[model samples]
Target: MSLGDEHGFGSESGDRRSDDSFGGSGQTRTRLPGGGDTDVYGGARRPVRNSRSLITVVGVVVLLIAAIAFANQGGGEEGPSGDGAKGTGSQPTAATGVKPVTGKNGQIPTGYAKDEQGAQSAAANYAVALGSDGMFKSATRRDIVQTVHDPAVTDGLLSDLDKAYSADFLANVGLTGDGSAPAGLTFVSRTVPVGTKTTSFAGDKATVEVWCTGLVGLAGPKSTKPVTETWFTITQNLKWVGNDWKIGSSSQKEGPTPVNGDNRASSADEIAGAVQGYGGFTYAR
Candidate 1:
């Protein structure tokens, strides 16, 4: 294995500056409660007080009020709109309309709808199937290739992958000649999608990028390739085939990776136990 880059989720904030420029010696004039200036008829004169600190405080308050108003303008009951909206189209991040398919074509998800959501769902599920440990087994690999790939590309892809997952490759990853783990070892190869985005889309075709984290290696004592995590992005070019989305072509890139954390690595037995105990999910957008 080739380990890919890892990505992290985050939000950004901006700094605001306060305006300190005010006219007339930076002093504010306040009128006294009673009169002070008298005009001709001997009336009480209006007292005038110049306070710089008060003026500065008032200015700061005004700037704060303006900043608050500007910040709140895009929020509240109306929800996010315009450029701040969640999604590019009618579909929101949360699930909507038709549910994901429960049907499968020999372990690969099948029968997605003819819409964007369906395409995304198909891509996400296909990524998981393609990255699974089953791909190392001849029979299961063939099934996955046939199920997910386009009919025209399936044969070529199977031939290419058969070469790619050669005996040497299997040995390097601690698998046997037939892609089986050693007597006491458990092979772990699984992908979990963090998120999905549609890069390009049309009525019958779509390009979806699935940001994923994966685990791969042997989980047992004396295993050289111990189970470790990797991050990558899989871009699937899908076509609406036979009422469902099928992978016409697919590629993987390193990642929008983040820095590694300080978590302690689990032991071989622990890794094996976890892999056996936990189950994967049917991912959807």
Candidate 2:
């Protein structure tokens, strides 16, 4: 079943974080980190000889560097620095450097800025909210859809998701008809976005991709299912809705997943304990 949630959702007109329309060649170049590079000394280098002059120049350069660093201590990211900063999907990259979203609707993040970096932040945080355990319940799921999705598609989305999470589906996932974990077991579902990039953006609309790693399944020694990890990518269609970015729609696919590492897998009790002990974070760009 497509679930319609993955690949089916998109932008109302604008929420942008890209060339794969933000459009064009798809390739991008950045000035470089810390903004750019410059010749501090502003002069050509000499071959071999002047020890005294070299020492004086080095001392001056060091002092200038220290001063510059001190002056730059508190500045925040202006926006997406370039394509590389957001990542290319094949490897890790630095953050888009956009600040975290400032407002939230209940527990769901809200009030995103109207900019590329803002779109990226919206996409990432929305992914987190959607992947949360709340999506499994009737009331909480309704609350989440209303908060993250554009009002135009909200009703249809609710209907589709209700069918998707039907009784049979709940049984398969080990959740009760009401979406509760069986007594003595912990049902865990969490999403952590690894990175985000724009596939297309035109101010009022944006298509962003979020790469994520998640935990799901039941956690308990006697339970038939034990929580496991999953990797997937969510392609979000975003639009500037009211004052914030909201999902037009979304779809999903398998992975840009990494190979499993050598760390030993935890016992079910340990997994359940960990889930109950640790709290999740609110995502940002």
Candidate 3:
């Protein structure tokens, strides 16, 4: 029962910022010390829960149970990267054969490594996966929901991500009913990590910061979705469970993002066509 799941759904927002209930500056939404409901933050009014603060507490219990089940199911998959290694106390070993993805949950198993480098690599890749265009499709979304997320957190996160990437949002991105681009157009939504850092780590818990640059828009004539780029930071509060790191909670904020470079902006049609034709990569450290 991750705190996220206990809440029922990610906090509702009034705008794009609202969709990111965890980051924007608003009143704090807190689950009560006991089971109940209450509103903690706001811009537009949303129902609030003041339930037992034990929501996250309970979610952890559920997570512990799920992890055990997951481990028992397959003895837990080993970290997909290198054997834990230490160097001149400098950068970490870049493990080969890193599976950016495995099962559908979108959980990056790379984080449970025995060392820091492994964690960093895992965190960066996980962030990219979470923010990728794959999040838009229903099938992939199901896989992501099952594979990457903690079971306790899955219910809530799935609901939120669903709303955040709803049909209306797909239309906003100039996609058809299933998030597919119309003929002669392309759709893009990807996060490119600039760097990653561990802000804090303890036992199986870590806070990893992923500095990323992303592009999101539809490229096509008469498309309203412009191929625009933005910078943001994704901070994931991860926990080591079932032999890998799983996001307990996550947040995103507008970045220390730099000014636009001299890169010429492409027309909607050009950008859309390229997006339709080109493919995104599985990012790594």
Candidate 4:
């Protein structure tokens, strides 16, 4: 799962020209239309509003006004602004009036402490849920996507993710074509966020980078996919939505991993047995 040819197998490539699908059919099939032929503003000049044209100038002014109004609204709720821009979740806040942790609709934890530490904790935990094995399944994938991602990006992200988890993609992970467990076997894929750093914070919009270690493989008799560990970094631009941190956008990159010494590799059976026998941890700050 983690060891793959393409980095953005299930992720939406930032390139607007690429056909990046979210969760439509899976990674192997179904390519969603992006900023290529289907993209409306893929041409040169970046489709800027022209000041020479009255209509274009008016449109540009309107957009600027709208953005200002939105930022003002966000700033009001956050009380005050710090070094960075408003509406980003980067500004430091007093812990006063902040409540203890609360679970998200009986699932995730929400309403983190109004301080730097709390935000970091929230980012780490949310990253884990976003990068878990449940993302491969349709039903659980929907829940995790809806819960973790910002609402604005949900539609596009869901579409792209659908294509990322296609039958072929699942097969590559050693699961059945439909992303199910094979008879007498178990599949494992999980992400553990080791730490988090805030890159930018304004209001509810904050960009956090999660240093992570992932475990992925198949555990069962006759299973050739051995569970393996990988180090990577996941960056999430999150927005505070409905009292919880929701991911507005996310991207992954290969790690600052350490070099490995020549070590004896475990047998396939041993790997399978360990994967099936051991459960993952509930990561937190």
Candidate 5:
């Protein structure tokens, strides 16, 4: 089975001082002929200086002051809140503040809550574990399957996966007979969650689709299967088991992918370094 086709679940501001002086020094003021009260230009004696104009200017100034006061009172446009948007009223893209489980079943995260959010979290975390480079190894692969799969189906799933990730399959992706990279190469398989949606959820069951982008292949000079990115969605049929969420079954499909941009691909060494340096997260929604 094609792994790619199957699992479908898936700025500084400067302050300026204002000058109060209306006119520059050494500028001469001309007086009108009447009583030095009007200018020589005689522009209708400044129109008797209407009190209504003064009132209107004062009204405008008052309105501006009120606006400034209201804005300051409302905290200046309600910028991004703790969850990262201004007045969005939407849930956070990722879980926060909720402490991760100290409990793990082998390498898989465990102790998830018995709720829809918990099920989504479990599926997302499991997707990462299942898509990691560790899945290529016999020991870790078995651990992962046992941890994530429903107990009733674990044995058969393991058997199927063993055959599916066979020596030839490993070799095609640049691993040796024992699933090790060539001496100079670093094998990479990493899945990063883009988002998750729960298509169906109940107390006892859940179906979660995890959208992800992954990097797989071998990273190094002279490697044939140079690491490349792919997008896929993994749909996991999960059941509430052992007080947590476990995978009953899963299938993957290609993608609701976007057009690739013009970004220059990173060098193999750079990719290797990055994979080694940056750690993956325990995803939740």
Candidate 6:
């Protein structure tokens, strides 16, 4: 089963971030590997966790993404404007569509075809990378932004992202200055792409939308900020750089959010166990 199902989340997926735990979306949260539940990039004491499904402080994680453009800024559904030829577009949520490529440069995927399908695959993979908990760390965040973003905007975008993930931002999300959870709590922040559609593909520029859902917050028996899910759509502007696709920019909007279901919310132990039981994947069309 997908990690989402192993946890309490059902199939399908957010912001491109919200603190609210959406019931049906497939977003799952994870804790950074360290130690007050956060590792010292801190200014306040953390709440204790005893594990009874506390819903309070769930919204505390929103600031981590809201400050980033990927969470607050977004465009309409219109494709790119130009004179390039356009296809009817492929099915985004289908189990299989685009052919998968097998390779990676560093940790990110590489070698996508130069067609509409490639754009969709690239967008999906990038959405996963951008929405991962790695963004909370300086070293990993730089690697992500630098590798996925076009060279022209890499420096500036990195600077912006650095500023966005400030110590204050980390603290707000229950993370310490170094981006780790407390002694026992696990901080979860993950994004799951439900579908991908290339809205515009002309020349080396393509715009793709990744409909996704995510989860963020603290998970522990006595924790008040239980991990919660969120829904959001990521609209990305990709540029064919070097021999592969790179993101020029991207923004997120709330979502074509799904209705919350009657599925039972699991205990903190279940959520944390689920995280440790699995690893992430290389998402494709």
Best by lDDT: 6
Name the better of 1 and 4 by TM-score. 1
TM per model? 0.66, 0.67, 0.61, 0.62, 0.66, 0.68
**What is residue 94's positional error in candidate 3, in angstroms?**
3.4
- For each of the candidates, give the backbone clash count: 7, 20, 32, 36, 18, 28
Q: List the candidate 6 regions with Cα displacement exceeding 4 Å.
A: 1-66, 69-98
Model 1, span 1-285: residue lDDT tens:
111110100011011112100001121233345544442112332122121111111111111111111111000011111111212222213345777676777555688788777888887777666555555567766886688777877776566555545576456445677767777776666666778888999999998877766555566677655555544566678888877788776544444545454334566677666666555554445
Query: How would you encode candidate 4's per-residue C-alpha lDDT over 135-244 as one tens digit per residue?
Result: 55666557766665567766766665556556665554555655565665555554566667888887777777767665554544565443445555555666678777
Any idea what lDDT model 5 has? Answer: 0.48
Candidate 5 all-Cα RMSD: 28.1
The superposed Cα distance between candidate 5 and the true structure at residue 188, in angstroms, equals: 0.5
Q: Alpha-carbon error at 244 in model 6, in Å?
A: 0.6
How does each model score on lDDT? 0.48, 0.49, 0.42, 0.42, 0.48, 0.50
Residues 1-285, candidate 5, lDDT per residue (tens digit)?
012212211000001001000000111223344443333122222222211111111101111111111100000001111012212332223454465565666445688877767877887778676655555567766786778778887776666555545576555445666656777776665566778889998779999877766555556677655455545556678888888888876655445556554344567677666656555554434
Residue 163 of model 5 has an lDDT of 59
Tens-place lDDT digits, model 6, residues 93-184: 32255557766765567777888888888888776666555555677667866777788877765665556555764564556776666657
Residue range 1-285, candidate 2, lDDT tens digits: 011112111121111111010000111222222321222111212112111111111101111111111110001011111112223222212236655655677666688778877888888877766655665667866887788888887887666556645676556556678767777777665666778888998979998887766555566667554444544566678889898888876655445656544344566667666666565555545
lDDT of 1 at 192: 67
* TM-score, cand. 1: 0.66
Better of 2 and 6 by lDDT: 6
Task: Provide the lDDT at 127 for model 6.
Answer: 68
